[model samples]
Target: MSLRRILKSWVERYFSDEEALILLLVLIAGFAAVIWFGRMLAPFFTALVIAFLLQGVVSALTRRGIPHLLSVIVVFLGFVGVLLALAFILLPLIWDQLIGLVQETPRMFASGQNWLDELQSRYPNLITPDQMQNWIGVASREISQLGQRALTLSLASLGNLLSLIIYLVLVPILVFFMLKDREALVGFTLSLLPQKRALMARIWREMDDQIANYIRGKFIEIIIVGTVSFITFSFFKLPYTALLAVLVGFSVLVPYIGAAVVTLPVAAVAGFQFGLSESFVYVLVAYGVIQALDGNVLAPVLFSETNNIHPVSVIVAVLFFGGIWGFWGVFFAIPLATLLKALVHAWPRGMKGRDERHHALASEESMEESL
Candidate 1:
């Protein structure tokens, strides 16, 4: 084919499917809106996500003969209870530990400096004493700056306490109504669309199930892994158990990267507390077992092969969406990537010609039947 014909064919091949075009346009618009107004719409998005996560629970309760409204109310109350517990109970404990750690910062720095000095003594040519001292100086200065920045940010957050309160109030209300009026919302959304929406419907159904399962699975995984880590660390008398446990728990979210990155803190805490003793070895072994069980047992039980996405793809999705939406993006990267994959597979190829012929045949058949 000529270059012009080739260009025309390519454009027609991709754009000829009206439903595909519509889906693409809608995705682009939605993405643009999020990028433009992410902060302003964060609460609504968060509420929507919470509603989606709780939907299965609501359905389960309704199936057990509870009324739909009652199910929603129960779930909403349970959610609020959990949030209150975290805010008042769990957070205070974590914060106290954090303050303790900060107060012990000088000891940590001294220990680190001693280790560096030992290294310099062993390998005099590799790391000079002056270089070690300079490195320590830089790190100390950086830590000071970091502490100041953290305090400043905390103060800033306090200033935005009203905004946080608004979110706390508004989100639950949105989630409650969303769960209660889900069918009506779905119907109203569908009513705005064209009648011919088979492809869109199929894609929507697939994405709905995939996203829901993924979110629920991750939630369970975090709780299980974090609890296990906390118990294991506590048994070993490790300091900062809560902080480390939280890291280890959420680390499961990023697959390979999360575990590897979180290992550092666990190791550092263990080494600092017990040096090369058997307690350190025991702590490491316990952590290894936890990770192994999480990967082999808990994950298989909770998540299915539906998340059979390639490792490379998962990493790329992490980078891409994480860049766009930070933590939330990283949290949702895999499911979002799966949605894109489904869309690509579902998009019709050579649809224009097929649709035209099918409509023509239907028109002729109708006329003959009328006659």
Candidate 2:
């Protein structure tokens, strides 16, 4: 048969409904497998993300005429220094509070039991004192068991400290190499594609730009939120202010739920120490003001065009990933979602179709300036 006839027959066969269904099923199965594997490798993935973020810093340093090796060392040392400073400033306070809380656990349980007993005596229709005592006993036992398990894990993992050391040592090294060789990697990958598809390199570069901008903007936002939270909590004379502020900062890394989760614990402690009404109002107002500032001022100034995710999408991604993969999932949901959005935006459009529909507004600006 002629080449045109053969080509027509091949297209007809391959683009049939049955072929399309099979392709769809295969794609779905492949995606499921990838997700399962990713879940299993979550920790390494987390480390890689950390490295990816730091790679930009390393690149900047190199661009400033710093040697790659020295830049990596400086970045790693800076990270360690920050961690040490936080530990020195915050750990002692947290240790004292933790010790006090541990010592007071029995007292808290007794107080709870006493309250239950008084309620039983007043009503005589609620749970009997004996039942309340049994419930307390069960709860106390569970708490004791959980504490023992946690202690055991901590102790047993001391020998495994070397693994963590290795990871810490390797990440900066990997990041330095990645930053130094990024262009080469891109060129090598693109070389494998046909000339017709070589323009994908530009698309990939745009995607990388989006990811880098979002990550850098996010870090700045977290720092701003943390600083604001620390100042607010300190002014209010809240308990565990340092720890709570750190929690708030980390929560800001996640979207939507971060502020709420950070505030809840701080509010609970405040309520217990002060009074319910005062603590509730204080935390509610403090977080509200901070959030308002973040939304109106800080975000617009720093992350103006970086992350354009809808609030609904943020909530859904957090819930879905958090459910499947726990804390890391929640922590990474927004960045990962942002990366996916970038990829979708970068995907090649049909030759005769509308091509700008999926692109971010920032990319349009870049295009306009280039033109």
Candidate 3:
């Protein structure tokens, strides 16, 4: 047979249905293995996230005429110093409030029962006090069990604390090397690709820009949310304002629904502490205002370009990852979504051919322009 006929026959043989099915299974298994491995390497994943976030700061310092080593040192020292200061300032307050809350748990339970009694008195058709008490008892038992489990987990990792310290020590060292050699790393990676595909270097740079913008925007948003929450809590004369505000603020890092998770518990406690009506209204209004500001003003201004994800995609990713990986999944949902979007845009259009590829490239270029 001629060479052309032999080439055509080889292609046809390789593209057979059985081969395709085998390939599909292989791909699926490979993907599953990757996910499992990623889960197993969770601590390294966390460290990588921390490094990615601090990269921009270190780069900025380096660009401003600081030596790379000194820049890394400065960034690391500043970070640790800030954390230490915050610990000194905030931990005592939080510790005291937590201790007080533990001591007052019985009183809080009584207050809850009183509130239930008031509700029953106002609406005689409601459930009986005995039923309510039973429900509360069940809830209390569950909460106590959860608390015990949490304490066990915390104490169980006492030996791992040394490893955590080593990780903390090594992170800045890794960051320093990464920041110093980032350009070289990029050049090396690009060199591995064929010359015809060098244009992809630009695409990678763009993706990096997108990720950096997102990280910086998120930092700003967290600060804004925390400050606003603290101010609002102080305005309402709420108990444990510092602790609650800090919780709410830090929870903002998780994207979409996390702020509410933090707020709801604080509000519930506030309701039990103050009158139900007063605390309910205060927390409701405060959180509502903060969310509105976040959605309308702060988000639009800072995250307008960074969050190119659709609401449906966000919800799907959150649910899928949350189910698979729990808290870490939820924390990483947005960044993961962003990375997925980048990959989708970068993927080759095979079935649709060059026209579709061109169109996709054009659309991506337009999106970059808009950004």
Candidate 1 residue-wise lDDT, 1-371, digit = tens: 79999998887887787777787887898889988998889899999888888999999999999999999889989999998998788888888887877777778778778888888888999998789879998989977997897788788977678887898799988988899999999899999887877677878888888899888999999999999999989888899999889899999999888898898878877878887689989998999999999989998788785658888999999989999999888998998899889977767666665486468669989999999
| Alpha carbon lDDT at 119, candidate 3 | 86
| Model 1 / residue 195 / CA error / Å | 2.6
True-vs-predicted CA distance for residue 209, candidate 2, Å: 1.9
- Candidate structures ordered by TM-score, highest first: 1, 3, 2
For lDDT, the strongest prediction is 1
Q: Residues 29-123, candidate 3, lDDT per residue (tens digit)?
A: 74587478865665556656666777889989889998988887787778677656765777778877766666566677678778888888888
lDDT of each: 0.87, 0.67, 0.70
Task: Candidate 1: count the clashes.
Answer: 0
What is the C-alpha lDDT profile of model 2 across 1-371, one tens digit per residue? 99999887665544443323343464477458647887555445655666667777887899999998788778867766765675577767766666565555566556656667777888887787688878988978966986787588668777557665665566555555555566787689667555543234444565566666666777778888888888988887877676677777777666667776766667655654555466658876887888778878877787666667888988888898788767767766776677567646543344211233335545878999999
Off by over 4 Å in 2: 1-47, 59-73, 83-163, 184-203, 277-280, 342-371
Global Cα lDDT for candidate 2:
0.67
Best by TM-score: 1
